[model samples]
Target: MNFRAEIDIMPLKELLDPQGKAVSSGLKKMNFTSVEDVRIGKHISIKLSANTKEEATTQVENACKKLLANPIMEGYKFELIAE
Candidate 1:
């Protein structure tokens, strides 16, 4: 079976996101005052062969924990689809 994983990694709410905050501030200066509390994150897509959706999810989760996301300051979520 072939599977695809769509992953999103974001900074933990307790941690400050400098890039997002900067963007929000810039937007306000540009007259986009309604924009507030902005945060930035990363998206990752992976395609691989797996025996089942559960297996694929576990694989992707391990990848995220081991390499993709920093556990100390980040959180991650993912979805799996058949492809």
Candidate 2:
């Protein structure tokens, strides 16, 4: 079986996002005042072969924990779709 994983990695809420803040400031300068705040994150898509959805889930979670996201500063979530 083949599976596709969609992952999101974001800075922890306790941490400051300078990139997001910069974008927010830029938006306000451009007269988009309704936007109060912004936070930037990464979206990742992965396709892999696995025997079952549970195996795919484990693979995706391991990827996130070991390489894709920083546990101390970032958090991640993912969804798996059968392909």
For each candidate in the order shown, give its overall lDDT on alpha carbons. Answer: 0.94, 0.96
Q: What is the C-alpha RMSD of each candidate to the true structure, in Å?
A: 0.9, 0.6
The estimated TM-scores of all candidates read 0.93, 0.96
Best by lDDT: 2
Which ranges in model 2 have alpha carbons more than 4 Å from their true place? none
- When summed lDDT is taken over every stretch of 10 residues in candidate 2, the lowest stretch is 52-61
Native-structure RMSD, model 1: 0.9
* Model 1 agreement with the true structure over 1-83: per-residue lDDT tens digits: 99989999999999999999999999999999898689999999999889988889889989999999999999999989899
Q: Look at candidate 2 and tell me the lDDT of residue 15.
A: 97
- Give the Cα error of residue 31 in candidate 2, in Å: 1.1
